[model samples]
Target: FIVGTITSGYYSINSYDYLHKLWLRQLIITSFHHALGFLPSYNILSSFILRWLGAHIEDNVKLAEFQQILRFPSNLLNIEHGVTTFGRASLTSFTMTKEGLCYVDEIYLGSDTNLGNGCTIMPGTTLPSKIIVGSLTLVTQKYASAQSNCVLLGIPAREMPFVIPDDTSVINDLSSLNSSSIYSLLFVCLSFFISKYLFIALYLSSPVAVALFIHAILFCAIYQYSILITKRRSHFTYSEVITHQQYFLFKLMSEFSTFIGPYLSGTQLLPFLFRMLGAQIGSDVILPDIRCITDPHLVNIGDYVRLNMGAYIQAHTFEQRILKLAPITVNHRSVLMSNTLILPGATLQGQNHILPWTLVMKDDQLPPNTKWSGVPAKQVP
Candidate 1:
């Protein structure tokens, strides 16, 4: 029964085939990706792996630690060198691994582009060379189309107040910037066991060594599992979105995201963490405080936006047998002051302002550069 159910669900997600597990090459490469892909740039291991996969990584390119950690599995890199100058951070592009058999095409990261920690450059995203993305920023749009020293913040990120990296990027990375090697993790565990005994029987004699080995293995497993979960969670599937059981699982992971997300607040890591959990974020947006994001995928935000404190943002409503989902577009250069409520399909045009305690309900459209306030958010003179 369980096998039948598993196969049926798999078939539903992929119409063409019921059993399309990852191919051998993909599986091996993916394992390595989670285990060691975060190695410092231009290192022999990274170069060797990319060469094996036919990646034409330029000699001038440098990859900082975790430069590709959060990158989706399906996204490939077209590496080149084009930086005008070098800085403290090694031009890091932390792309993680793909999910399912359908991988997206290669994405180009021009030389001299510096991405701060907790920033996500999604698949199909290309940034022009020399752009500086502030930390904790989420970039959904490709900058390869433009060249600027734009600093973006918040969800659905937008270009905001300009501040040089040397001045603003001094905060500690919200998450650990360091990555580990698979071999090192294994060796550490083996040494702990081996040091306690000359042979297998001797090793088993010490309960402390056995316990330590188990703990080490569990830690490694949790870290790798997190990478895997983040990859799958970020890539939305139809079945997961609509099916009640599947949606439950999706919500389950999101609950975990919510727990860790707040700690990343006001840092350069919150946006990346939020994006993986389902929010559609843009460049140079600021999110000092994020309200409840009931369903993040259903939200759409534009550039240069600021969502102030005490805001409640929702994207879905439930009643009877159907669940309704709609996108909320808060356009460019907008601000929602304290205690604002936004509902599904609410479209706020660019350069708009919402006074405190405003409620923008379902399907409401406010014109550009307008000021609104009230229980139902009426335009104010």
Candidate 2:
């Protein structure tokens, strides 16, 4: 009995220690991810953190803010030098079958590879060097043997007969033009820590509901004040060197919006908050996710509109290294379904229904009472 008791106690202590370490690691990762969302110099900062976490990330790799690496240890992921990623690329190292089986493996990206916005790199996939992947592409393990110097596009990401350009110099130029200073990151960290502690103190002293209400009010007031002081404009060309400061300020505002979106999303407070930030939001609008609208001030939404999950309103685009800004209008009673992307200068007339996964191109205007569907959205009879 004595021997059995001693063995069980030893096992229990070991289990507890293991669980504690696991929890601490997860906490650190989550905190790091949230902090990186608002901080500038995303590529450099993220690469440093990722290397610390044991990922094999080489020099000169550009990782965009808000990208996701999921379901694998950091050591299982490998990224080579000069690889660049744009907007929210997801590298998932695990997959589950319908029958409850799971597969997990390493993911590798070769040198000078580029992944576009909203692309997915599946488990066990290996991308070759000098490969250019288009936006919204899905790269599977079958492409592991693909040749370098090719373009990949579409849902399943088939290769196109196009030669990949050596745009390393261009990427470096853009990075210099757009990178935010460390001071901005420090400011964001300070604000976040102060707000976090304030909320904790309030929660300890007051009822939950009252504490939340007061915190929300104070947060909104501070956020609005900051926005007002920035003196932002609706339209501006972003190519000139003189406008770099203004561009950085614009990025800071965007980061703030992204940081606070989850707290007010799907609530009545969201529309009010957007209005305070200069958006022309009308009555009875249902905004499930505010993150979808990158530039709220450049957006105008009419009455009784419903924007579903993943419905994106992009008010700006970059062409030939020049940033073009425009307004997006969703007329009264329009419904934007899941994953609908409305590009800059796109307008949807009254009572229009945009189906799931639709892409409304720039400057495209749809008629009233129309139902649209597909990648480049077309009217569905």
Find the candidate with the highest TM-score and give its number. Answer: 2
Q: Report the number of clashing residue pairs per model.
A: 32, 0
Off by over 4 Å in 1: 1-255, 289-291, 319-322
- Alpha carbon lDDT of each predicted model: 0.49, 0.66
Clashing pairs in 2: none
Q: Which portions of model 2 show Cα errors greater than 4 Å?
A: 1-43, 65-67, 97-101, 129-134, 143-152, 159-264, 317-324, 376-379
Candidate 2 structure lDDT: 0.66
For candidate 1, write residues 77-159 as lDDT tens digits: 55655321111122222223344433233455665555543345554566666565543345663433474556554443466
Estimate, for each residue in 105-128, the C-alpha lDDT of model 2 and write its tens digit: 678898878776667888778888
